[model samples]
Target: MEHRIRLAGPAEAAPELACLRVIARLPSHWSVEILECGTGYAILGLRTRVPAEEAVARIDEAIAVLPLLGWRRD
Candidate 1:
């Protein structure tokens, strides 16, 4: 299954850096990538075979710390 999260922030190197940060927080079995980046938002694509609820929980947990890195959900 695939899930997407939109992070609102500067569109510069911040997006790539944020992607790395998120990747570090997720389980190794999951695949993550940047799907789109705009002036003030970035879309991250997460792919995993985990159940929907578990996936959402893991994603939320990973992103919960994003604010400290200067990002917020969009």
Candidate 2:
């Protein structure tokens, strides 16, 4: 499953990038792609063998704790 998450602001780029880097370095069931979109960045999240909703929930849980990286899911 893959999800494209739109960030709330450009200020989130640094912390989000840092967090994604850490996630990439660890053993995981998922992969994330960060791309610059004008002033902000977008995240493309992919998880194999997981339901689409579950993958989204996992990403939501990860982003919820971040002060600035959270975005509106709707």
Candidate 3:
């Protein structure tokens, strides 16, 4: 399933994003940075898992779309 990721720009928003839940089947996930509350905006990245046979194609689609999800780890 495709997951939608949203950014929380405030410290208060952290709890919501920091504690985001995902299905167990999805790969391990975590944020590069725990953005300071009420300080900066966070960029979020999202993609759905696909079967090996379909991965390449889906990757292309993911690439075509803006990686609204954050690309940097640091």
**RMSD after CA superposition, every candidate:** 2.6, 3.9, 10.2
How do the predictions measure up, each by TM-score?
0.71, 0.54, 0.22
What's the C-alpha lDDT at position 59 in model 2?
59
- Clashes in model 3: which pairs? 10-38, 11-37, 11-38, 44-69, 44-70, 45-69, 45-70
Tell me the deviation in Å of residue 62 in model 2. Answer: 0.3
> Residue 38 lDDT in model 1?
68
lDDT of 1 by residue, 1-74 (tens): 98887877655546666667777888998888889876767788888998767866765676678443556666
lDDT of each: 0.73, 0.52, 0.33
Instruction: Report the C-alpha lDDT of model 2 over 1-74, residue by residue, as the tens digit.
Output: 55565544445356456446434543375666654343344545454677777766765665655553444333
Candidate 3 local lDDT, residue 9: 34
Supply candidate 3's per-residue lDDT for 15. Answer: 36
TM-score, cand. 3:
0.22
Which parts of model 2 have CA positions greater than 4 angstroms off? 10-27, 35-38, 67-74
Which residue runs does candidate 3 get wrong by more than 4 Å? 1-4, 11-26, 29-38, 50-74
Which sections of candidate 1 miss by over 4 Å?
A: 10-13, 66-69
